[model samples]
Target chain A: MSRPRLTFLESSLPYAVNAARLIVMDRGMFVADFFLATTVPFLMQFLIWSYLYQGSSISRSFGVLSLSQTLFYYAFSIAFGRLNNGYDVVSNLSLNVREGTLEPHLLRPVPYPLQKLADFMGGGVVYSVPIILVLAVFVFIPPVALNSFFWPGWVLLVVVSQILCFTLSWTVAMMSLWLVRTDFALSLLTTSAAFFGGELLPPYLWPEWLRPLMSYNPFRFMISAPAQAIVTMDGGFVMTALAWTSFYAIAFGCLSAFLWRQGMKRYRGAGG
Target chain B: MKKYLLFFRLGLAVELAYPVDFIGYVFTTLFVHLTRFLFLNGVFDLTSTLEGWTRRDVMVAFIFSVLLSSVVDSFTPSIRTFVRYAHTGRLEPYLVQPLDARWVMIARWIRPGSLFIFAIIAPIAMLTLSNLNVHPTLLQAVGGLFALVIGAIVNIAVMATWSLTTLVSKRDLPTEFIFRQVMRLNQLPPSLFGYKALTALVIFLPIVLTSTVPAMVVARGEYFLLAPMLGAAVLVMILFMISFRMTMRVFDGSGG
Candidate 1:
């Protein structure tokens, strides 16, 4: 009798399940992460914006968004920010490279990047539940309402942006193969994303000179585009964002492949 | 004190050996702070004032926040090492040292790269203050500096207490993540949260003492704020000491 052969999906499913299981097991850390990463930041933004928009002739609306809409933007962005986060990918890859753990992964039949992607998706599954719950509160709770038609576009952008975020993170992580340490690189990447991705401030509020950079950055696709899709309810914007995100995702995917190939040439493993 | 100085010197020497890493650290710190400043600029453009906090006042608060963060970042490695030692039962060496065990645990290691944050940000801070026309009196200057020092102590005590949780929980919960997020609250004036939240933060968490009070003391010549800041610092320090003793008593070292 011949042994059964597993397809790509079959092989990858376990990695995702294992990653999700680990996240579920670490309930304490996950809760803390959700609260600190999403809830607290949103609260801070709420207080700041509420105080700023309090008594003014500006009529509650700043640029394209009213105060409540702006709050919803932040609530969605912060939650989706955590949902699409790639820090674990960077940390895990760097640790593997440093410890020469890549040797085993290379020997495995499956591609290393696919394995990592599977793991990333698995962890994201665990995070997406709470993120959806949080967004539900923002959408269903009074004082903030969203058009039902925008939900499909919002979901499409989020799905595409996750791929873009993962690819960008993977590309950045490949640099650890050549660098002595990646702590600085990690910090730079995180700050740049937060600043340029409209996490800290909306694109409408950005200075005119910074408009080009703010519009074209990969992080904008990952963070601001999806948030805007729901709040702005513009089909054209969502389609444009989806197209750009797909372009960046493919570009980064190719770049990551090229870097990994070149890095493997320099890979001497533990003994070298 | 001499031993601590020696440890600091050794850490500095090690940091100096990696000049490239130090430069990268400085650049990254600058980028982070500059972006934060720009974000504040965007906010100020929308409104002239936020809850009576002018752009200049917020800038002052931001500088103080940076100082507090720098101090905590410098000591972060020591806190991590203490947590690791607690888990691995490797704390015996520090315990056997002639120095106080608690001090040894918290001050044995340092990341000297973090000290460069001061050099990088101080000039920028000074320029921003000058642009705001914030010149403190001599006495106000002294009080501001005192408040900053106490603020750092309170921040460190809070982190130390958080790290001590590893002994009781037996899990290396990502205390650094929580610490960093909590520290984010200091980036703005606590008063923006209103009086009730400010009182709660001061009494329970005391994070307001880390930056807001010091900024007010320096920028607005509010010397009366120092008394509450000092009191909070002393109270937090006592709490840290108590937690440290109790946690250490229960620590049956998990084998390294």
Candidate 2:
């Protein structure tokens, strides 16, 4: 019997359904997990920054307009930071590779890397959307002021940046293919990304000598670019931000594909 | 004690087998700490102090927090693996051993690798002391040592409590989640929080005893708090032991 060739939509349906099912089944766990993962870190950052500004003049430093403005910056940064979670892809790939399960996956209908990417994006869709919507609500509320020039293009830029964030994280995770032991590399990447990505502190507040390093750094494109777009509505910065983000997205995507191909040639599975 | 030494040697050998991994880990730890130092520098640049805490005072407290965290990390891998053993019904070997199962489990997973954290801790501690305008007396140093020792015990007891919960539930306890919360809270100096929050941390969380109290003792010569902190650590240790025994009893009697 001949089986019908499944279209892209048809093949993607199963992965999408699986993702949606996991979301429904683990709804409560997701809430708590997201709270602990996103909220706690956000609150800790707020606490630290508040203490820094405490008993000091309440004026701007690092281009932040006010304390409330600074808090808003950190609050959304953490929310956007959610898109950078790549632990699952790294752990799952390394475990499969080590256990020799990846050999079977290689023979499956869908490309193995695509399957993994689909899974990553599926989970991302579930986690990042609601949080973004909630932040948008807060940004529009009375106390929290957006830049006067805020427009639809700003939201589109954020969405594109988030997609770039996911691709870059996945590419970084693909380094597991070469290292085999991804734990060390994964932590190193994540720690560096969080620091350089400006999740810890804004890059403007970064040391003057370090500013050149941060300006050219792709990691800054992932975090600070979108943030700048949201806050400063300057046309020139927005164009540059979009350009760098799209450039990295394409660059890392090609790198990841190249690495996967090279890694597959070198792979000899662990025998059971 | 001999068995523990033997286990420690074996653990060190295992960790040292992967030289690249070890070096990478050490550097990552140093880098993480460096970022923290930078964060504090950024803050102190803007203001003279954080809620009345000078740079040296905060630095001392930060080192204590890192030290306590390292101690916990050193021991909890074994505790987590032990929980996995229980989950998979592979705990029979430990149960059949002549020694106490809890003690054996605790001794099994001590990674000598974490001892390297002190490599950073030592130099930072010295720098912090030298940076201090007030010269600490020998008595304050001795009192601080006592507080640190007692604080380590309290932390161990807290870990054991969480590890024991895995046995009772026959599943993994989210020890990492709890540990993260504790570490973040401990990073804050006790002075920053209100009296009620500080009291809650002291009695309930007890991480305050680990870093904040000891840092206070050493930096400000607050020796008066040492007696109560030691007393609290002892009480927590006793409670932990009792809880472990009861949890083991339940595990032994259950078919699962």
Candidate 3:
């Protein structure tokens, strides 16, 4: 009898599960990681913004209606920031390239990028739990919840943003094939995204001239756009976010493919 | 002391070996600081003060925070190296040497790349001070320098204590991640935190001493804080020494 062949989902599911397993392997570390990275930063932001908005006059100056809304924006932004983070993608891919471990990955039945994508999605599955809890608080809690009519649009923005974030990271990580190190590049990418994506400062607060750049950046779609949609309760903004994110996803996806091919050729030339 | 100086020279040489990487790091540091400067400018544009801290006062705090952070970054061992050494028994060689093993672990992996950030910080600090039209008295300047040295001692002691976790834990925790996040709290004026939170941080972690206290002393002439800051630094160093002794008892050749 012929051996049974596995479907794409069947083949990829194990990789995803393994990645998720690795993330939650140490329960103590997992909790500490979440607390330190998310809770502490969010609390700091809350303190700073609360101090800033102590005066009703200054709250108006921030263009944010109330302290609650500003706090909600930061809370969701930090959660989404964790969801869309790509530091591991860059670090892992660079390590593989540097150590010639790409050979085994290339020879896998599934494509290399697909394997990485599965792994990324798998890890994201573990991370998405906190995000869901955060959203639940905002949705079910009477006091903080905004009865926004743009829930469906916000959902679409979230889906598209994940793909865009992954593609952008993959494209950047491909630089490791040529460069000796990608840590500097990774730092630059993350810092720029945090600034432009409205995690550090909201788009509403940006100067008029810088508004265009903020809107057009890839990171804006991944982080701020989804947070902004819910915070501002703007239906039109959600559509814009979906469109921009999808466009960048496709562009970066293609760029990543091209780079992978070029990198493979170089790898072969160098006996990788 | 001479051997530690040699280690520093070795680190500088190693960093210079990869000029492109060094330059990239410098650029990234510049970009991060520039964005922070712009963010502060945007906040100040809307309001002149944050918790009674004027734009100039906050800028002073930010500059000192960055400077202290750079000092920590320059000398601290990369967490990856620490973990690798622990896992592979590479640290065993250093333990048997005549030098202090704890200092060897740190001195061997110094990243001089962070020092290049000072080049970017100095120019920005000068321009910001000029723009803010703030001048510090000579006494305040001296106090600020003294506070900075004490702060560095506190910060390093805290980190060194945290680094001992690798000897006890089976899996390495993201200690560096926690450290960086905690360090970021330095950027804000310590006064922004509540009395309880500020007291806890000062007594236990002393992170605020690294940036906020010095900034307050220099920018606002808050000389009263200097004595407490020194006390905190001394407390932290003692705690670190006790922890180091306890951890060393359990540490084996490889990760325990």
Most accurate candidate by TM-score = 3
The DockQ of each candidate is 0.56, 0.36, 0.62
RMSD of 2: 4.0
Q: List the residue pairs that clash in candidate 3.
A: none
Residue A189, candidate 3: alpha-carbon lDDT: 73
lDDT of each: 0.79, 0.69, 0.78
Error of 3 at B212 (Å): 1.8
Per-residue C-alpha lDDT of model 2 across residues B97-186, encoded as one tens digit per residue: 676676766767667676778766777677767776646688877877788788888877777776676677664445554455445555
- RMSD list, candidates in order: 2.8, 4.0, 2.7
How far residue A19's Cα lies from its native spot in candidate 3, in Å, is 1.3
Q: Tell me how candidate 2 scores on lDDT.
A: 0.69
Per-residue lDDT of A39 in model 2? 71
Arranged by TM-score with the best first, the candidates are: 3, 1, 2
Error of 3 at A87 (Å): 0.7
Question: Can you write out model 3's per-residue Cα lDDT over A1-272, one digit (the tens) per residue?
Answer: 99799899999998999989988886677787788777877877787888777765463567754677788788888778878888778877877776566678888999989998889888888888778877788667745444455777788788788888899999989888887467687887778777888887787687888878877899888887888778777788888888999999999999999998988777742322
Report the CA-based lDDT of candidate 3 relative to the real structure: 0.78
**Once model 2 is optimally superposed onto the true structure by TM-score, how far is the C-alpha of residue B83 displaced, in angstroms?**
4.4
Task: Provide backbone clash counts, one per model.
Answer: 0, 0, 0
